[model samples]
Target chain A: GDSVTQTEGLVTLTKGLPVMLNCTYQTTYSPFLFWYVQHLNEAPKLLLKSSTDNKRTEHQGFYATLHKSSSSFHLQKSSVQLSDSALYFCALSPSNMGYKLTFGTGTSLLVDP
Target chain B: GALVYQYPRRTICKSGTSMRMECQAVGFQATSVAWYRQSPQKTFELIALSTVNSAIKYEQNFTQEKFPISHPNLSFSSMTVLNAYLEDRGLYLCGARRTGVQDTQYFGPGTRLLVL
Candidate 1:
């Protein structure tokens, strides 16, 4: 079985502050990790993905480095913006599974001005 | 770029009735589609996985009779929640991925269902 765990249920920050959402995973096989963001009333869009260890993958001003040794892929942003308020989900899929995604509980990010 | 579209962004159905939602993939072939339910307080729960030219697989607690899925082609898929109840109230999302891809799932806007 494969599972994803994001401990932060909610993260609140002021504009221009830094952002980090913790994610850890457990899998029986090599895992592919992903981060997806869902804005209010919008679909969840891919933020970043990585299968290689210690390699930082980034997109849309956010970045995450997969650490196979630690079994974690923590999402980070240098500076947060008001527009970054949304629900962020960390997901993983075992190498042998086809198109099946195990998702985290999700972290609701709120950025204030 | 790949885009997934879902129909009837929001719907209201009474208990004991049924509602169907569709997912369409554009710009790329979707060899597999996974259905999930996002509850108000819980994370996304995988409902089923539908692959073209293969048998559909439903997760534990989800059955084909309750959540029937149809993947007739590479670009389209649909699922119906039969006998909707209060417990069925949630956002239903369809994620499409190309065949052989392990973790790349393009998600649709999702249908918000309200059971009364």
Candidate 2:
């Protein structure tokens, strides 16, 4: 069985501030980690994903490094914008699982002016 | 680019009724399609996984009798939720992927189900 954990339930910050959303996973097989962002009343969109350990992947000003040693793929951004407010989910698909994804209990990010 | 489309973006049904939703993949073949339900205040729960050649597999607490899936081809899939109730109300999403060709699973704008 595979599981993903997003420790923060909600993160509220002001615009221009840096933010980091913690993500950690547990699985028996090699893990493919993904970061998905969902706006209010919208479908979840893929933001970034990585399977290579320790290699950083970036998309839309957000970056995450899959650390096999720590089993973590934390999402970070240098500067948060008002549009960055949304629900962030960390999903894990174990290698050989055939496209089955186990998602975390998403983290809601709220950026204020 | 790969895209997945779901029909009937929103639907409402009476309690104990059944509802069906469809998923279509464009620009690529969808060898595998997974159905997930995102309930309020809860995470996405995988209802079942349907592959092109293999039989559909349902997760724990989900039964084929309750949620039956049909995957007749590589590009399309449909699922029906029988006996819908208040607990079954959620956004049902379909995640489709091309086996061996890519690892990313493209998701469709889920069909929101409301049970009255």
| Candidate number of the best TM-score | 1
* lDDT tens digits, residue span A10-113, model 2: 99999999999999999989898999999986768889999998899999999999999999999999999999999999999888343789999999999999
lDDT of 1 by residue, B1-116 (tens): 88999998999999999999999999889989999999889889899999899999999999999999989999999999999999999999999996556568899999999999
Which parts of model 1 have CA positions greater than 4 angstroms off?
A96-98, B99-102
Q: Can you give the DockQ of every candidate in the order shown? A: 0.68, 0.63
Quote model 2's TM-score for chain B.
0.97
Q: lDDT value for candidate 1?
A: 0.92
Q: What C-alpha RMSD does candidate 1 show over the true interface residues after superposing them?
A: 1.9
| TM per prediction | 0.95, 0.94
Give the top-scoring candidate (DockQ).
1
lDDT to native, each model: 0.92, 0.93
Model 2 DockQ class:
medium
Candidate 1 clash pair list = none
Model 1 residue B93 lDDT score: 95
